[model samples]
Target: MKTNVATTLAELKKNEKDDFYSSISFANEEIPLEQESVKRKLDKYLRKFSYLERSSHQIHRKADQLLPRIAKILKSYGIPDDFKYIAVVESSLNPGTTSHKGAGGYWQFMPATARLYGLRVNGKVDDRLDLTKSTHAAARYLKSLYSEFGDWTLVAAAYNVGGGSLRGSLKRQRKDNYYDLKLNAETAAYVYKIISMKTVLEKG
Candidate 1:
């Protein structure tokens, strides 16, 4: 006898509804959830994103066009591919957007940061909007943060909250792990969003 996959799915869904209510009742009883027992379930929940498909064909096309040039520059400076996803999340391959705070371009560099990184800013031209130049600048900044924190997650967090801010948060939280730290909302979600975008885009 062959098992019907649709029937199995229906049964699983029924079981899931039962389990959800059961868990709710247990939670209301003030019982601590067993971390080990629920680890698989939590992993399954988070991995829902694994099915996400990248629909921005134009973004992929632009990334393909830009990545080789970006990678060549990063390689010359000894930077890592992890930084590429930052660009993916920042501008989605769009170079013309400016954040309300004045961050502009594919890498979204603010005016001060852009100037600090040796990018020129003028009335008519902002080098931060230049893809090749801004990517190289972001690489150098991320590399500097990596040297400071000695952790990729921390370095990535520093990109959002500033190295000084993350350093203070690390001390206050007593954890260097980015996911474990109580970061500002935007910074807290930033790394995970980047990872998710990269995973979907690469797989798609």
Candidate 2:
């Protein structure tokens, strides 16, 4: 019985590792998990992102309520449902949070970007603070990014680092691929973290 239990535990760990390191579809694109470089980065983030499992009770609870609504909104805009994880990445499924740069709410829309996407962001009415409005605003912004990058991975990167900055990096590095392009630390880790968060929420 002890030997059998040990074998089962080992098998479980192997399966969990495979689940973390295996190829996954993100934004309707197949990520090349067989690639060594991609696997390493993903493993690194999965190790760090494991904190979510330990300290994410509230996040998980809120996500149970919010993700379905976010999914419907993303689908209506023709976005892949995977993009809903961006909210988890941005604000950990918490609303009414603001970044130092003024990106706020679940989707983390900056005031200017929120307004550009047809959300009102003013003293009297900061629409970025509203879950439904901010999500719609995020969809429009992500759609614009997709239009610009023509690739979902690049679109996700552009969402993090700003389209213009991502474009400039692609031009300078001569690499259009998110994994290949040279980026700041935060942007470099952004896609991996999103993937990790998606795995955690879905697998749990």
Candidate 3:
């Protein structure tokens, strides 16, 4: 079993390297690749790294396992598929993790935010650490922010910073785009980090 696993990993590595080289072609001092071809390569690499073969039921397990169920919940709530990454970013889809700042659960809500969103927060019980309840709260909050901002990126930004703060920054900078606006270090890199994690999880 060990030898087989090692061989499988080696094959996957070789395949990924092949995919990388095959997709890139240099021209006019720039690199370009056909969209369809690149996507095929990526899809192949992602399939090789699929979570279905893994047995370690930790963060990856939680994220991979819960996504389908969470998708259903989000669909029922009329939320977009993109919001799925928010739960992954929050607690790595783990229900047991807690931040030092007191954020908890798959959605990682602070005490105040959890309370405001109607998730119970107390010594005897902390529903902020519960995946289902927290995700529901997060979905609702994100939907409300989307209604206010009319942009998914802005809603993501507001999730990092407060909605009022993000709106103020947009007004001051005269740019509503999250990628273009100057934000605090944490908020600035937050979305990109989430995106990177998404790529890794979806492709690993």
Candidate 4:
């Protein structure tokens, strides 16, 4: 079993290095891999998630325990099940991971964002750390974003950089497409990370 897992991960890395990826997608939107830059960018994240982060074994173990609950909550809100990958990309399925900016929980919601989405984040309690509560909050937040952006790819981008910042970038750049926008480095690659996680986690 250990050897099989290692082989699978190694195969993923090898495939990423080649043109084995004939297509890529996010939120039902087909990524235009005909564009060499887009293909390379996504391939980089694929390698990062499949090989460079916590071991595939560790991430898969945590994901096995977490994604089902996250998926159920997202579906309850009428959101795409694919959005569960947001949690994977954000926190690597680690319920206790905290960001330097004080964002905590599986969904990585900052204090203000957590409170805005009906989560309590006071001194005595931080609902952002609760799996069920935070996943629900994240679903509501994603629904709100989808209403505004009307695109799951854009919603994913907004989730990382905030709706306001994404709107400003879209306006300044005169581009509604997430892939074409000149966002900050992090936001630009954010969707790709989610998609990468989706691909690896789902395929495995």
Residue ranges of candidate 1 with Cα displaced over 4 Å: 1-55
List, in order, the clash count of every candidate structure: 0, 0, 0, 0
User: Candidate 3 residues 115-163, lDDT tens each?
Assistant: 8988999989998777678778888888888799987767887998989
TM-score on alpha carbons, each prediction: 0.74, 0.88, 0.70, 0.87
Error of 1 at 97 (Å): 0.9
- Per the 3 Å backbone cut-off, how many clashing residue pairs does candidate 2 have? 0
RMSD of 1: 9.0
lDDT value for candidate 4? Answer: 0.85
- The lDDT ranking, best first, is 2, 4, 3, 1
Worst 10 residues of 4 by lDDT: 17-26
* Model 4 alpha-carbon drift over 4 Å, by segment: 1-23, 53-56
Residue range 1-204, candidate 1, lDDT tens digits: 247988898899979855743442110122122444333433342254344333336777776788777777777777766567678778876889888998888888889998888899889889988888997798889888878997776777789889999999989889956656777878877766665555555555
Please, what is the whole-model Cα lDDT of each candidate in the order they appear? 0.70, 0.86, 0.71, 0.85
lDDT of 4 by residue, 29-126 (tens): 76877778898898798888777444648888878888898888899999988889888888877768999999898899999999999999998998
| Candidate achieving higher lDDT, 3 or 4 | 4
Better of 1 and 4 by lDDT: 4
The residue pairs in collision within model 3 are none
Model 3 Cα shift for residue 122 (angstroms): 1.2
